[model samples]
Target: MAEGKVDPVHQFTIEPLFGTDHLSLAGYNIAFTNSALWMAITAFVLIVFVGGGAKQALVPGRWQMAVESFTGFVDDLLRANIGASGRAYLPYVFSLFMFILFANMLGLLPLALVGLHPFTPTSHFTVTGVLAIISFSIVLIRGFTKHGFHFFSLFVPHGTPLAMIPIIFPIELISFMVRPFSLGLRLFVAMMAGHVLLEVLSGFVISGTNAGALTFGIAALPSFLLMVGICALELLVAGIQAYVFALLTCVYLNDAENLH
Candidate 1:
Protein backbone atom coordinates (compact mmCIF):
# COMPACT_ATOMS: atom_id res chain seq x y z
CA MET A 1 0.00 0.00 0.00
CA ALA A 2 1.20 3.49 -0.91
CA GLU A 3 -0.01 7.06 -0.54
CA GLY A 4 -3.20 7.92 -2.50
CA LYS A 5 -3.97 4.19 -2.82
CA VAL A 6 -7.21 2.77 -1.43
CA ASP A 7 -7.10 -0.08 1.05
CA PRO A 8 -9.17 -2.82 -0.53
CA VAL A 9 -10.25 -4.20 2.84
CA HIS A 10 -11.23 -0.85 4.30
CA GLN A 11 -14.84 -1.30 3.21
CA PHE A 12 -15.20 -4.31 5.47
CA THR A 13 -14.28 -2.37 8.60
CA ILE A 14 -17.05 -2.28 11.21
CA GLU A 15 -17.41 1.32 12.32
CA PRO A 16 -20.14 2.83 14.43
CA LEU A 17 -22.65 4.98 12.63
CA PHE A 18 -23.21 7.09 15.75
CA GLY A 19 -20.63 8.94 17.87
CA THR A 20 -19.59 6.33 20.42
CA ASP A 21 -18.63 3.12 18.68
CA HIS A 22 -17.58 1.33 21.85
CA LEU A 23 -19.96 0.35 24.63
CA SER A 24 -19.01 -2.53 26.85
CA LEU A 25 -21.32 -4.15 29.39
CA ALA A 26 -20.29 -7.13 31.48
CA GLY A 27 -17.05 -7.45 29.49
CA TYR A 28 -18.86 -7.87 26.21
CA ASN A 29 -18.77 -5.02 23.67
CA ILE A 30 -22.37 -4.48 22.60
CA ALA A 31 -21.78 -1.37 20.55
CA PHE A 32 -23.90 -0.78 17.46
CA THR A 33 -21.82 -1.13 14.31
CA ASN A 34 -22.06 -0.50 10.56
CA SER A 35 -22.87 -4.17 10.10
CA ALA A 36 -25.84 -3.69 12.39
CA LEU A 37 -27.01 -0.69 10.39
CA TRP A 38 -26.92 -2.64 7.12
CA MET A 39 -28.76 -5.50 8.78
CA ALA A 40 -31.41 -3.09 10.01
CA ILE A 41 -31.69 -1.67 6.52
CA THR A 42 -32.05 -5.19 5.17
CA ALA A 43 -34.83 -5.85 7.65
CA PHE A 44 -36.58 -2.61 6.76
CA VAL A 45 -36.51 -3.52 3.10
CA LEU A 46 -38.13 -6.85 3.87
CA ILE A 47 -40.76 -5.10 5.94
CA VAL A 48 -41.59 -2.91 2.97
CA PHE A 49 -41.99 -5.94 0.76
CA VAL A 50 -44.29 -7.62 3.22
CA GLY A 51 -46.24 -4.47 3.99
CA GLY A 52 -46.31 -3.17 0.45
CA GLY A 53 -47.47 -6.49 -0.91
CA ALA A 54 -50.20 -6.93 1.69
CA LYS A 55 -52.81 -5.50 -0.65
CA GLN A 56 -52.78 -8.55 -2.96
CA ALA A 57 -54.28 -6.49 -5.73
CA LEU A 58 -56.61 -8.31 -8.04
CA VAL A 59 -55.14 -6.93 -11.24
CA PRO A 60 -51.68 -6.28 -9.70
CA GLY A 61 -49.78 -3.02 -10.13
CA ARG A 62 -46.10 -2.80 -11.11
CA TRP A 63 -44.59 -3.07 -7.65
CA GLN A 64 -47.17 -5.64 -6.64
CA MET A 65 -46.40 -7.70 -9.69
CA ALA A 66 -42.68 -7.51 -8.95
CA VAL A 67 -43.28 -8.69 -5.42
CA GLU A 68 -45.53 -11.51 -6.46
CA SER A 69 -43.13 -12.66 -9.18
CA PHE A 70 -40.22 -12.83 -6.75
CA THR A 71 -42.35 -14.74 -4.26
CA GLY A 72 -43.44 -17.11 -6.98
CA PHE A 73 -39.84 -17.68 -8.04
CA VAL A 74 -38.86 -18.69 -4.53
CA ASP A 75 -41.95 -20.86 -4.28
CA ASP A 76 -41.02 -22.60 -7.50
CA LEU A 77 -37.48 -23.10 -6.27
CA LEU A 78 -38.66 -24.74 -3.07
CA ARG A 79 -41.16 -26.93 -4.82
CA ALA A 80 -38.62 -27.99 -7.42
CA ASN A 81 -36.12 -29.32 -4.90
CA ILE A 82 -38.06 -30.19 -1.73
CA GLY A 83 -41.49 -30.89 -3.25
CA ALA A 84 -44.83 -29.87 -1.75
CA SER A 85 -43.53 -30.22 1.80
CA GLY A 86 -41.22 -27.27 1.15
CA ARG A 87 -44.08 -24.78 1.26
CA ALA A 88 -44.05 -24.86 5.03
CA TYR A 89 -40.52 -23.43 5.07
CA LEU A 90 -41.14 -20.79 2.37
CA PRO A 91 -40.88 -17.84 4.75
CA TYR A 92 -37.44 -18.85 6.00
CA VAL A 93 -36.09 -19.69 2.57
CA PHE A 94 -37.53 -16.56 0.93
CA SER A 95 -36.23 -14.28 3.65
CA LEU A 96 -32.77 -15.75 3.32
CA PHE A 97 -32.81 -15.20 -0.43
CA MET A 98 -34.11 -11.63 -0.28
CA PHE A 99 -31.73 -10.56 2.47
CA ILE A 100 -28.69 -11.90 0.66
CA LEU A 101 -29.86 -10.63 -2.70
CA PHE A 102 -30.48 -7.15 -1.38
CA ALA A 103 -27.21 -7.06 0.56
CA ASN A 104 -25.22 -8.20 -2.45
CA MET A 105 -26.80 -5.83 -4.95
CA LEU A 106 -26.83 -2.93 -2.51
CA GLY A 107 -23.11 -3.50 -1.86
CA LEU A 108 -22.38 -2.88 -5.54
CA LEU A 109 -24.02 0.53 -5.73
CA PRO A 110 -21.68 3.48 -5.27
CA LEU A 111 -22.17 5.20 -1.94
CA ALA A 112 -21.88 8.60 -3.59
CA LEU A 113 -24.79 7.75 -5.82
CA VAL A 114 -27.11 6.43 -3.12
CA GLY A 115 -25.85 8.34 -0.08
CA LEU A 116 -25.29 4.93 1.52
CA HIS A 117 -22.20 2.82 1.83
CA PRO A 118 -22.49 -0.46 0.01
CA PHE A 119 -21.39 -2.55 2.95
CA THR A 120 -22.17 -6.19 2.32
CA PRO A 121 -22.94 -8.18 5.47
CA THR A 122 -22.73 -11.47 3.61
CA SER A 123 -19.12 -10.66 2.72
CA HIS A 124 -18.31 -11.06 6.40
CA PHE A 125 -17.85 -14.59 7.67
CA THR A 126 -19.75 -14.05 10.91
CA VAL A 127 -23.00 -13.14 9.17
CA THR A 128 -22.80 -15.97 6.70
CA GLY A 129 -21.49 -18.35 9.37
CA VAL A 130 -24.60 -17.76 11.47
CA LEU A 131 -26.81 -18.44 8.45
CA ALA A 132 -24.90 -21.65 7.80
CA ILE A 133 -25.21 -22.65 11.44
CA ILE A 134 -28.96 -22.10 11.34
CA SER A 135 -29.28 -24.17 8.20
CA PHE A 136 -27.16 -26.87 9.77
CA SER A 137 -29.24 -26.81 12.93
CA ILE A 138 -32.42 -27.16 10.94
CA VAL A 139 -30.92 -30.14 9.18
CA LEU A 140 -30.07 -31.78 12.50
CA ILE A 141 -33.32 -31.06 14.32
CA ARG A 142 -35.69 -31.72 11.45
CA GLY A 143 -33.73 -34.68 10.18
CA PHE A 144 -33.78 -36.39 13.52
CA THR A 145 -37.34 -35.39 14.36
CA LYS A 146 -38.63 -36.51 11.00
CA HIS A 147 -36.74 -39.78 10.71
CA GLY A 148 -35.31 -40.35 14.23
CA PHE A 149 -32.17 -42.54 14.33
CA HIS A 150 -32.39 -43.14 10.62
CA PHE A 151 -31.05 -39.60 10.04
CA PHE A 152 -27.66 -41.02 10.96
CA SER A 153 -27.94 -43.06 7.84
CA LEU A 154 -27.21 -39.89 5.90
CA PHE A 155 -23.55 -40.60 6.58
CA VAL A 156 -23.81 -44.31 5.82
CA PRO A 157 -23.17 -45.24 2.24
CA HIS A 158 -26.05 -46.98 0.49
CA GLY A 159 -24.09 -49.96 -0.92
CA THR A 160 -20.82 -50.02 0.99
CA PRO A 161 -19.44 -53.26 2.36
CA LEU A 162 -19.96 -54.03 6.04
CA ALA A 163 -16.21 -54.24 6.58
CA MET A 164 -15.69 -50.76 5.03
CA ILE A 165 -18.50 -49.15 7.04
CA PRO A 166 -16.08 -48.32 9.83
CA ILE A 167 -13.69 -46.60 7.40
CA ILE A 168 -16.34 -44.75 5.35
CA PHE A 169 -18.42 -43.51 8.27
CA PRO A 170 -15.90 -41.03 9.66
CA ILE A 171 -15.17 -39.50 6.27
CA GLU A 172 -18.83 -39.00 5.52
CA LEU A 173 -19.46 -37.63 8.99
CA ILE A 174 -16.68 -35.08 8.63
CA SER A 175 -18.03 -33.97 5.27
CA PHE A 176 -21.52 -33.64 6.68
CA MET A 177 -20.27 -31.61 9.63
CA VAL A 178 -18.20 -29.28 7.44
CA ARG A 179 -21.17 -28.22 5.31
CA PRO A 180 -21.85 -25.02 7.23
CA PHE A 181 -18.25 -23.87 7.08
CA SER A 182 -18.08 -24.59 3.37
CA LEU A 183 -21.36 -22.79 2.67
CA GLY A 184 -20.37 -19.69 4.60
CA LEU A 185 -16.86 -19.59 3.17
CA ARG A 186 -18.13 -19.89 -0.39
CA LEU A 187 -20.39 -16.80 -0.17
CA PHE A 188 -17.96 -14.75 1.89
CA VAL A 189 -15.02 -15.39 -0.38
CA ALA A 190 -16.97 -14.78 -3.55
CA MET A 191 -18.35 -11.44 -2.35
CA MET A 192 -15.10 -10.24 -0.72
CA ALA A 193 -13.05 -11.15 -3.79
CA GLY A 194 -15.36 -9.32 -6.18
CA HIS A 195 -15.43 -6.16 -4.06
CA VAL A 196 -11.65 -6.25 -3.56
CA LEU A 197 -11.07 -6.61 -7.27
CA LEU A 198 -13.42 -3.69 -7.94
CA GLU A 199 -11.57 -1.55 -5.41
CA VAL A 200 -8.17 -2.49 -6.83
CA LEU A 201 -9.17 -1.67 -10.39
CA SER A 202 -10.71 1.64 -9.30
CA GLY A 203 -7.47 2.36 -7.47
CA PHE A 204 -5.62 1.86 -10.73
CA VAL A 205 -7.86 4.39 -12.41
CA ILE A 206 -7.33 6.84 -9.59
CA SER A 207 -3.57 6.51 -9.73
CA GLY A 208 -3.60 6.75 -13.50
CA THR A 209 -5.65 9.96 -13.36
CA ASN A 210 -3.01 11.56 -11.15
CA ALA A 211 -0.10 10.48 -13.34
CA GLY A 212 -0.89 12.31 -16.59
CA ALA A 213 -3.33 12.50 -19.46
CA LEU A 214 -1.39 9.82 -21.30
CA THR A 215 -1.63 7.37 -18.42
CA PHE A 216 -5.26 8.27 -17.79
CA GLY A 217 -6.13 7.60 -21.42
CA ILE A 218 -4.20 4.34 -21.61
CA ALA A 219 -4.42 2.81 -18.14
CA ALA A 220 -7.42 4.49 -16.50
CA LEU A 221 -9.65 4.05 -19.53
CA PRO A 222 -9.19 0.29 -19.74
CA SER A 223 -9.31 -0.11 -15.98
CA PHE A 224 -12.57 1.79 -15.80
CA LEU A 225 -14.02 -0.38 -18.60
CA LEU A 226 -12.95 -3.52 -16.80
CA MET A 227 -14.43 -2.27 -13.57
CA VAL A 228 -17.72 -1.69 -15.34
CA GLY A 229 -17.65 -5.22 -16.71
CA ILE A 230 -16.83 -6.60 -13.28
CA CYS A 231 -19.67 -4.59 -11.74
CA ALA A 232 -22.07 -6.19 -14.21
CA LEU A 233 -20.69 -9.62 -13.42
CA GLU A 234 -21.06 -8.90 -9.69
CA LEU A 235 -24.75 -8.11 -10.16
CA LEU A 236 -25.21 -11.51 -11.75
CA VAL A 237 -23.13 -13.14 -9.00
CA ALA A 238 -25.28 -11.51 -6.31
CA GLY A 239 -28.47 -13.15 -7.57
CA ILE A 240 -26.80 -16.45 -8.47
CA GLN A 241 -25.14 -16.75 -5.08
CA ALA A 242 -28.41 -16.04 -3.26
CA TYR A 243 -30.19 -18.64 -5.40
CA VAL A 244 -27.39 -21.14 -4.83
CA PHE A 245 -27.59 -20.66 -1.08
CA ALA A 246 -31.36 -21.08 -1.01
CA LEU A 247 -31.25 -24.05 -3.35
CA LEU A 248 -28.63 -25.73 -1.19
CA THR A 249 -30.84 -25.17 1.82
CA CYS A 250 -33.74 -26.88 0.09
CA VAL A 251 -31.46 -29.73 -1.00
CA TYR A 252 -30.22 -30.23 2.54
CA LEU A 253 -33.77 -30.07 3.85
CA ASN A 254 -34.78 -32.62 1.29
CA ASP A 255 -32.01 -34.88 2.50
CA ALA A 256 -33.10 -34.41 6.09
CA GLU A 257 -36.75 -35.22 5.47
CA ASN A 258 -36.37 -37.89 2.79
CA LEU A 259 -32.92 -39.22 3.84
CA HIS A 260 -31.61 -39.89 0.35
Candidate 2:
Protein backbone atom coordinates (compact mmCIF):
# COMPACT_ATOMS: atom_id res chain seq x y z
CA MET A 1 0.00 0.00 0.00
CA ALA A 2 2.81 2.39 0.88
CA GLU A 3 4.60 1.56 -2.35
CA GLY A 4 1.42 2.20 -4.30
CA LYS A 5 0.84 5.41 -2.38
CA VAL A 6 4.31 6.82 -3.16
CA ASP A 7 3.78 6.90 -6.91
CA PRO A 8 4.69 10.25 -8.43
CA VAL A 9 1.82 10.07 -10.89
CA HIS A 10 -0.56 10.16 -7.92
CA GLN A 11 -0.17 13.91 -7.80
CA PHE A 12 -2.12 14.29 -11.00
CA THR A 13 -5.20 12.49 -9.73
CA ILE A 14 -8.38 14.53 -9.68
CA GLU A 15 -10.26 14.04 -6.40
CA PRO A 16 -13.64 15.49 -5.76
CA LEU A 17 -13.75 18.10 -3.02
CA PHE A 18 -17.11 16.88 -1.91
CA GLY A 19 -15.75 13.31 -1.54
CA THR A 20 -15.82 10.07 -3.55
CA ASP A 21 -19.31 10.56 -4.92
CA HIS A 22 -19.86 13.11 -7.66
CA LEU A 23 -22.75 15.42 -8.34
CA SER A 24 -24.55 15.53 -11.67
CA LEU A 25 -26.62 18.39 -13.00
CA ALA A 26 -28.58 18.32 -16.22
CA GLY A 27 -26.52 15.40 -17.56
CA TYR A 28 -23.30 17.16 -16.71
CA ASN A 29 -20.88 16.09 -13.98
CA ILE A 30 -20.72 19.25 -11.88
CA ALA A 31 -18.67 17.89 -9.02
CA PHE A 32 -16.09 20.33 -7.71
CA THR A 33 -12.72 18.62 -8.04
CA ASN A 34 -9.14 19.65 -7.38
CA SER A 35 -8.82 20.84 -10.98
CA ALA A 36 -11.93 22.96 -10.57
CA LEU A 37 -10.58 24.36 -7.31
CA TRP A 38 -7.30 25.47 -8.86
CA MET A 39 -9.19 26.93 -11.82
CA ALA A 40 -11.33 29.00 -9.44
CA ILE A 41 -8.24 30.13 -7.59
CA THR A 42 -6.64 31.15 -10.87
CA ALA A 43 -9.70 33.16 -11.83
CA PHE A 44 -9.91 34.84 -8.43
CA VAL A 45 -6.25 35.81 -8.56
CA LEU A 46 -6.75 37.30 -12.04
CA ILE A 47 -9.77 39.28 -10.93
CA VAL A 48 -8.03 40.69 -7.88
CA PHE A 49 -4.83 41.50 -9.72
CA VAL A 50 -6.60 43.26 -12.58
CA GLY A 51 -9.29 44.94 -10.48
CA GLY A 52 -6.91 46.22 -7.83
CA GLY A 53 -4.68 47.69 -10.50
CA ALA A 54 -7.49 49.39 -12.40
CA LYS A 55 -6.95 52.60 -10.44
CA GLN A 56 -5.00 54.70 -12.91
CA ALA A 57 -2.63 57.10 -11.21
CA LEU A 58 0.53 58.92 -12.23
CA VAL A 59 2.69 56.88 -9.88
CA PRO A 60 1.72 53.22 -9.87
CA GLY A 61 2.23 50.67 -7.12
CA ARG A 62 3.82 47.27 -7.64
CA TRP A 63 0.53 45.60 -8.53
CA GLN A 64 -0.43 48.42 -10.85
CA MET A 65 3.00 48.36 -12.46
CA ALA A 66 2.73 44.61 -13.04
CA VAL A 67 -0.68 44.99 -14.63
CA GLU A 68 0.49 47.82 -16.86
CA SER A 69 3.66 46.01 -17.83
CA PHE A 70 1.75 42.89 -18.81
CA THR A 71 -0.76 44.96 -20.76
CA GLY A 72 2.05 46.73 -22.60
CA PHE A 73 3.81 43.46 -23.33
CA VAL A 74 0.68 41.96 -24.86
CA ASP A 75 0.05 45.17 -26.74
CA ASP A 76 3.55 45.07 -28.21
CA LEU A 77 3.23 41.39 -29.09
CA LEU A 78 -0.01 42.01 -30.93
CA ARG A 79 1.33 45.08 -32.69
CA ALA A 80 4.38 43.24 -33.87
CA ASN A 81 2.62 40.04 -34.92
CA ILE A 82 -0.94 40.88 -35.91
CA GLY A 83 -0.68 44.63 -36.55
CA ALA A 84 -3.57 47.10 -36.22
CA SER A 85 -6.33 44.55 -36.72
CA GLY A 86 -5.05 42.55 -33.74
CA ARG A 87 -5.91 45.47 -31.46
CA ALA A 88 -9.54 44.38 -31.48
CA TYR A 89 -8.62 41.00 -29.97
CA LEU A 90 -6.40 42.54 -27.31
CA PRO A 91 -8.69 41.70 -24.37
CA TYR A 92 -8.95 38.05 -25.36
CA VAL A 93 -5.27 37.49 -26.05
CA PHE A 94 -4.22 39.26 -22.87
CA SER A 95 -6.67 37.30 -20.77
CA LEU A 96 -5.51 33.96 -22.16
CA PHE A 97 -1.84 34.79 -21.59
CA MET A 98 -2.37 35.93 -18.01
CA PHE A 99 -4.58 32.96 -17.16
CA ILE A 100 -2.01 30.41 -18.34
CA LEU A 101 0.83 32.36 -16.73
CA PHE A 102 -0.95 32.49 -13.40
CA ALA A 103 -1.95 28.84 -13.55
CA ASN A 104 1.62 27.76 -14.23
CA MET A 105 3.16 30.03 -11.61
CA LEU A 106 0.59 29.13 -8.99
CA GLY A 107 1.34 25.45 -9.55
CA LEU A 108 4.93 26.08 -8.41
CA LEU A 109 3.82 27.29 -5.02
CA PRO A 110 3.47 24.66 -2.28
CA LEU A 111 -0.18 23.83 -1.80
CA ALA A 112 0.41 23.49 1.96
CA LEU A 113 1.15 27.21 2.01
CA VAL A 114 -2.10 28.11 0.27
CA GLY A 115 -4.30 25.43 1.93
CA LEU A 116 -5.47 24.10 -1.42
CA HIS A 117 -4.96 20.93 -3.39
CA PRO A 118 -1.62 20.99 -5.17
CA PHE A 119 -2.83 20.51 -8.70
CA THR A 120 -1.97 22.17 -11.99
CA PRO A 121 -4.93 22.47 -14.30
CA THR A 122 -2.74 23.39 -17.25
CA SER A 123 -0.92 20.07 -16.80
CA HIS A 124 -4.12 18.32 -17.81
CA PHE A 125 -5.13 17.99 -21.46
CA THR A 126 -8.74 18.94 -20.77
CA VAL A 127 -7.95 22.50 -19.72
CA THR A 128 -5.27 23.15 -22.31
CA GLY A 129 -7.34 21.40 -25.00
CA VAL A 130 -10.30 23.66 -24.31
CA LEU A 131 -8.11 26.74 -24.59
CA ALA A 132 -6.61 25.56 -27.86
CA ILE A 133 -9.98 24.58 -29.30
CA ILE A 134 -11.41 27.99 -28.47
CA SER A 135 -8.57 29.76 -30.21
CA PHE A 136 -8.89 27.52 -33.24
CA SER A 137 -12.65 28.02 -33.32
CA ILE A 138 -12.19 31.78 -33.27
CA VAL A 139 -9.79 31.59 -36.16
CA LEU A 140 -12.12 29.37 -38.19
CA ILE A 141 -15.16 31.52 -37.51
CA ARG A 142 -13.34 34.77 -38.23
CA GLY A 143 -11.76 33.40 -41.35
CA PHE A 144 -14.92 31.94 -42.84
CA THR A 145 -17.02 34.93 -41.92
CA LYS A 146 -14.58 37.44 -43.34
CA HIS A 147 -13.36 35.59 -46.46
CA GLY A 148 -15.96 32.85 -47.05
CA PHE A 149 -14.75 29.98 -49.22
CA HIS A 150 -11.66 31.96 -50.02
CA PHE A 151 -10.46 31.13 -46.50
CA PHE A 152 -9.47 27.76 -47.90
CA SER A 153 -6.76 29.59 -49.78
CA LEU A 154 -4.84 29.84 -46.51
CA PHE A 155 -3.82 26.22 -47.03
CA VAL A 156 -2.39 26.92 -50.50
CA PRO A 157 0.95 28.53 -51.11
CA HIS A 158 0.83 31.81 -53.05
CA GLY A 159 2.99 30.72 -56.03
CA THR A 160 2.50 26.97 -56.08
CA PRO A 161 2.22 25.21 -59.47
CA LEU A 162 -1.16 23.68 -60.35
CA ALA A 163 0.30 20.16 -60.15
CA MET A 164 1.84 20.81 -56.71
CA ILE A 165 -1.29 22.56 -55.44
CA PRO A 166 -3.12 19.24 -55.25
CA ILE A 167 -0.37 17.67 -53.16
CA ILE A 168 0.22 20.68 -50.88
CA PHE A 169 -3.44 21.35 -50.11
CA PRO A 170 -4.10 18.15 -48.20
CA ILE A 171 -0.81 18.41 -46.34
CA GLU A 172 -1.56 21.97 -45.34
CA LEU A 173 -5.10 21.03 -44.40
CA ILE A 174 -3.84 18.27 -42.10
CA SER A 175 -1.34 20.60 -40.50
CA PHE A 176 -3.98 23.25 -39.91
CA MET A 177 -6.33 20.69 -38.38
CA VAL A 178 -3.59 19.44 -36.05
CA ARG A 179 -2.93 22.90 -34.62
CA PRO A 180 -5.14 22.76 -31.53
CA PHE A 181 -4.07 19.25 -30.49
CA SER A 182 -0.43 20.10 -30.95
CA LEU A 183 -0.77 23.31 -28.96
CA GLY A 184 -2.55 21.60 -26.09
CA LEU A 185 -0.23 18.58 -26.07
CA ARG A 186 2.84 20.77 -25.92
CA LEU A 187 1.70 22.57 -22.79
CA PHE A 188 0.20 19.50 -21.12
CA VAL A 189 3.28 17.38 -21.66
CA ALA A 190 5.69 20.05 -20.48
CA MET A 191 3.74 20.91 -17.34
CA MET A 192 3.00 17.30 -16.46
CA ALA A 193 6.60 16.15 -16.98
CA GLY A 194 8.02 18.89 -14.78
CA HIS A 195 5.60 18.34 -11.93
CA VAL A 196 6.09 14.56 -12.02
CA LEU A 197 9.85 15.03 -11.76
CA LEU A 198 9.41 17.29 -8.77
CA GLU A 199 7.15 14.78 -7.08
CA VAL A 200 9.62 11.97 -7.68
CA LEU A 201 12.49 13.97 -6.19
CA SER A 202 10.31 14.84 -3.21
CA GLY A 203 9.61 11.17 -2.71
CA PHE A 204 13.32 10.44 -2.73
CA VAL A 205 13.88 13.00 0.00
CA ILE A 206 11.40 11.21 2.25
CA SER A 207 12.54 7.65 1.48
CA GLY A 208 16.18 8.59 1.84
CA THR A 209 15.66 9.95 5.34
CA ASN A 210 13.98 6.75 6.46
CA ALA A 211 17.36 4.95 6.41
CA GLY A 212 19.61 7.31 8.44
CA ALA A 213 20.33 10.99 9.08
CA LEU A 214 23.62 11.07 7.11
CA THR A 215 22.14 9.25 4.16
CA PHE A 216 19.12 11.58 4.31
CA GLY A 217 21.31 14.69 4.11
CA ILE A 218 23.44 13.21 1.37
CA ALA A 219 20.43 12.21 -0.73
CA ALA A 220 18.37 15.28 0.03
CA LEU A 221 21.07 17.85 -0.76
CA PRO A 222 21.57 16.97 -4.42
CA SER A 223 17.87 16.29 -4.89
CA PHE A 224 16.96 19.60 -3.31
CA LEU A 225 19.55 21.48 -5.38
CA LEU A 226 18.35 19.83 -8.59
CA MET A 227 14.74 20.55 -7.66
CA VAL A 228 15.62 24.23 -7.26
CA GLY A 229 17.28 24.26 -10.67
CA ILE A 230 14.28 22.51 -12.21
CA CYS A 231 11.94 24.95 -10.50
CA ALA A 232 13.79 27.84 -12.12
CA LEU A 233 13.57 26.11 -15.47
CA GLU A 234 9.88 25.46 -14.87
CA LEU A 235 9.36 29.16 -14.24
CA LEU A 236 10.94 29.92 -17.59
CA VAL A 237 8.87 27.18 -19.24
CA ALA A 238 5.68 28.58 -17.72
CA GLY A 239 6.21 32.02 -19.24
CA ILE A 240 7.45 30.66 -22.55
CA GLN A 241 4.52 28.27 -22.93
CA ALA A 242 2.03 31.03 -22.20
CA TYR A 243 3.72 33.34 -24.67
CA VAL A 244 3.89 30.60 -27.30
CA PHE A 245 0.20 29.84 -26.93
CA ALA A 246 -0.68 33.51 -27.22
CA LEU A 247 1.68 34.09 -30.12
CA LEU A 248 0.30 31.10 -32.00
CA THR A 249 -3.19 32.42 -31.44
CA CYS A 250 -2.13 35.72 -32.96
CA VAL A 251 -0.53 33.95 -35.90
CA TYR A 252 -3.71 32.00 -36.53
CA LEU A 253 -5.68 35.22 -36.33
CA ASN A 254 -3.37 36.80 -38.85
CA ASP A 255 -3.82 33.80 -41.14
CA ALA A 256 -7.56 34.17 -40.81
CA GLU A 257 -7.47 37.84 -41.61
CA ASN A 258 -4.71 37.98 -44.21
CA LEU A 259 -4.47 34.39 -45.52
CA HIS A 260 -0.88 34.30 -44.36
| Every candidate's CA RMSD | 2.0, 2.2
Candidate 1, backbone clash total: 0
lDDT of 2 by residue, 1-260 (tens): 23423688887898888673458888788888888999999999999999998889899999899899999999888888888888988999999999999999988887656565567899999999999999999999999999999999998988999999989999999999999999899999999999989888877777766657886789966787888999899999999999999999989888997787
Total backbone clashes of model 2?
Answer: 0
Model 1, runs deviating above 4 Å: 1-3, 24-26, 114-116
For model 2 the local lDDT of residue 151 reads 98
Over 4 Å off, model 2: 1-5, 113-116, 213-218
Model 1 pairs in collision: none
lDDT values for all models? 0.88, 0.89
